[model samples]
Target chain A: MAKIKNLAELRKMREEQQKQLNLREKSNDPEKYVQIKVGMATSGIASGAKRIMDFLIVELDKRGIEAVVTQTGDMGYCYAEPTIEVTRPGEEPIVFGYVDTQRADEIIEKYIKNGELVEGIIPVNYESID
Target chain B: MAQQLKMQLLVCGGTGCRASESESIEAALARELKAHGLENEAKVITTGCFGFCEKGPIVKVHPDNTFYTQVTPADAREIVEEHVLKGRKVERLLYTDPENKEHVPDSRHMGFYRKQIRIALRNCGFINPENIDEYLARDGYEALGKCLAEMTPDAVIDIMKKSGLRGRGGGGFPTGLKWEITRKSVADQKYVVCNADEGDPGAFMDRSILEGDPHAILEAMAICGYAIGATKGLIYIRAEYPLAIKRLKIAIDQAMEYGLLGKNIFETGFDFDVELRYGAGAFVCGEETALIHSMEGSRGEPTFKPPFPSVEGYMGKPTNVNNVETFANVPIIINKGADWFASIGTERSKGTKVFALAGKINNVGLIEVPMGTTLREVIFEIGGGIKDGKEFKAVQTGGPSGGCLTQKHLDIPIEYETLVEAGSMMGSGGMIVMDEDDCMVSMAKFYLEFTVEESCGKCSPCRIGNKRLHEMLETVTEGKATMETLEKLKNLSNVIKDTSLCGLGQTAPNPVLSTLNNFWDEYLEHVEDHKCRAGACKSLMRYVIIPDNCVGCTACARNCPVNCISGERKQVHEIDQSTCIKCGTCMEKCKFNAIEIV
Candidate 1:
């Protein structure tokens, strides 16, 4: 690892580093890029959230899609262990459930790239606090 | 550059999960991946504590985001074969709702994570703690960078003030005010100290933050140093937290190597370095003044304020002391504007608080929620209600210095002021839920005993007054106390609270006062009726036989360990009140369920 010369160098390194990680931070500018959050709590990990997150990252990057996928702690949807919340440009975040590789592929290809909804959509049940 | 991998599996490497053999799970997953010749396609990463430690050894699969819980090393083979090879989620490892038989596949729908906001613990469970790049990728040091580059020390303090961030070290002091006081104090050499002693018995959110995201503390400390015009920082942590210590050392070394710390930071001529100091973990030493005294090689006992740590701290120089969780929130407050934080929590306490939810909780773990969130939301909604479907009795927060809150206070929003009004304080965010089985009087005694042990003895009111209070509660539990002793208990506890030297002694009687106020009827039952309705105080309960239910069962007579049951065979069993012990073995032995406690 090289010593970062300044904040710019550090920021540059972080931008590159973030690509390897599925960084799913919610951004104020929703139209910038697609953001995906995979539930990676204990249940998520035991059910194989790491694999799904990695697959989404690698496959999305491979497919030349602009997206940020990251690991989020339990979103309280433990019933949907392999769950991912996908938000495309200027759209609401939609949570999907029990996403096996087949579902992950369809989610990325249809929902992400072509802007179409697919199966395994886990409805958001919680009401936001004022 | 190489393309992204096809799949990834993340195993929880938290202390709880590691104790449950998550390491073996990680190794087994890697081996399985290698055996399948998919090592290049799939990756296995071990992250930090997921905060859901109740069901540990958690494994998460990426690409599809499958969450599996309570996974042992033995299940790794099937996880790899079925889940990894064929992309089928291993159904057995999934968390099945205890109430409902439905298997929960994602953590998002779980009751534990729904109401939680996770501000202080934002980066905790998600990333690998050891990797500096991972920390940086999450906009980690951007706060410090922004502080040094754009904002002046006063400007940074202004942002903190506007954010309304209070000290999460149980003090509830305004963080910005503490910084401003230290900044105004005249000193040549100043220091910024992070109090990570976290001596609360069941509290570990501080420990988790250190282990999960050590860089967060380091980054926040640097920002603090920058904000307070100090170049040296110290972390006063407990020796018991070896993992947190090791991770902090790694983060410091990495930051130093990356030019994030130690001289000419960001090429802005700003220099800051962080060092670690281990404490014996005296609960009283959590007080900032005492903590500073301990750091300075003086007596660990707390001294009077006005000369508070901000004015006279760390070798008698101006200093700033903040809790680990307090500092953990700094970087985020800087990165995102103060208003972003101020918008989340209540008007007074403008951010989320990380609570170590333990004791009689269905989902016992760390949860960070917005400050305005209610106790009902925490205990029932996020904690999955009381354990075993028992009725909730009370919750003890703020460690020994805090008081117990009853069911009537459940709906009240959990702000610092709100908790204080309810005869409880949110001390370091330790929420220990107690069920109906727990006795309020004994619960007060339990906290009093802890206070008696941890008292610095710097003052006599706490030393003598707390002892007397305990003796009264002790006598009450033994069913030997009169109503006069109960009055003495309340009076003595008030004296202790009023005259104690430090926060330790000042708030020592909170448990006794709070319990007596909340459960006065229970206390009356113990003193007047000589009965413990909860059956928690064993000496107050007696073992007897209901004559109607006793159908000449000799089993009670034979099983009585002390031969206290003297009735002959084919006759109603009678437990001799004088000689009988309250062991309840006769109750267990009686096939007719004749024996009962009267």
Candidate 2:
């Protein structure tokens, strides 16, 4: 580690560390960041949902996007194995079906980064009450 | 690929939780995470006190915010497997509300944390105190860097003055004014002192802050050093706080290596450094004058105030002394502007006050609540009410120097002036709640006994007056004092308060005076009827056997250590009143619920 020489140096170090050290901070207010939930039930896992979840987790950070990627039970879209729901800040959650690494990257680039929609959109048919 | 933390397991490393083996719990968590190959995915960080000490060791899972209480080392495996792996909360370990008996998974829903506003304790239970990087990540030394690079000495002092922060060490003096006074004093060698000598009984607020976030103190002291035009800073911490001392040393070394502490910090041509001065844990040394004296290798006794510490402190050089909690709040006030802090608390007392809540309370822990939070809210809402479904008798604030506040004073907002007006000073924020079972007369005697023991015998008023005060309390509790004795007790307490030289001697008689003012009826009963309603005064209590209820099993007679109970087997017993020792051992031995204290 280098010694902080000036205000600019300290600020630079803080800004760099803040990004890497923001997991706990992001968790505090998930709504402020991009929240992604992957289906991880038995049926979903049999269809390589684990690989897709890992791909999303690694790819999102590599792209310098702040996000909380958590796993949930089957979103009742067993027909579309490896389903994922993406909720951007102040936006409604959108479910994308048959999400592989390719589609996950497209979702990150088109949907998450630019707020543009891509194909394989699964419209909500049920109201999930909290 | 950079290691992305999906989850963080925050195990409480505060002194209270550590006593319950939180360190082993942290290791067990790390081990379980390693066994499952989820070590990098989920990080287990040993943070400072979570403040919910009643149910510890506490393991809080971040992102999901699942709060697990009373966790043992053995439960770590299940937490890593179930909570970490499967994203399932451990049902049994959740904090069950004392009112509804419903398990609350998150801390946000619990009554203990709902009303608290953590400012002084902002980084306490969050970051690893040993790592300066984590502290930096949370804008740790930004205040010092900002102060050195941008603001002038007077400019920084103006911010402190506008923030309305008082000295959290029970004196309620304006912190900025103290700094200004020291800055005005013409001394080539002025000093900034952080008073970490927290000697209040049952108070660990300062100790927790030091152990949890030592850098906060270091940074604040440097900021004070800059504001007061002082190059040297000393932390007068008690030697008993080994963990705090260790952490402070680590923080100091780390800050120096980072070029944040020693000389020419931030290349701003400002040099400020801090070192620790250990107190022998004398309660009187908590006072600034006594603390300065003790640091100077002299007697730990306070001197008269016209030449205050800010004027002629620490080798006759102007020295500024502030409490640990007061220093802890400085960085936050500087980071978030004065108005932001000034908006949280009451008019006179700004920012939050950290209190070590103990005694007969459901949640006995360290809590920081904003000023003007009522006693009812702290005792009932945040404290989870009295323990064992008992009625609250009185709440004692400010340690031995503070006074007891009864039920009538519950609704008053807890500002410094309000507490003092209600016959109690906020002396280091030790709030001990007393339940119905605690006797008021005996409670006053208990505090008097502590004062008698801790009173630095520098003045005759404190040395002799407090000793005589304790004797009068003894006489009252023993049921031998008349009404004339009570009058003398009140008169002597006032004399001690008026004639004493220092704050310790001045406030030593508060408990006696306050209890006498609040529970005069209880005192009358002890003196006139020769009976203690609470049964706390043993001498005033008599053990009598209920004739009808006695089974005559000879248990009481056989177990009586002094042979006070005499009866043959299969016959009712009779207690010899003259020979009874009031030990109440026979009461425990009775099987038929025969013996009762009258």
In order, the interface RMSDs are: 7.4, 2.3
The sequence of per-residue lDDT tens digits that candidate 2 reaches over residues A1-130 is 5678997888778887676567677776688899998887777778877778778878887788888887777689999988999999999999999988889889999999999999999999999964
In angstroms, the error of model 2 at B70 is 1.6
Give the chain B TM-score for each candidate.
0.96, 0.97
Maximum-DockQ candidate = 2
Number of the top-ranking candidate, with lDDT as the measure: 2
Q: Candidate 2 residues B158-252, lDDT tens each? A: 99999999999998999989999999999899999999999888999999999899999999999999999899999999898888899899999
Pairs with steric clashes in candidate 2: none
Off by over 4 Å in 1: A23-64, A67-130, B1-4, B98-100, B549-563, B568-570
lDDT of 1 by residue, B155-175 (tens): 999999999999999888999
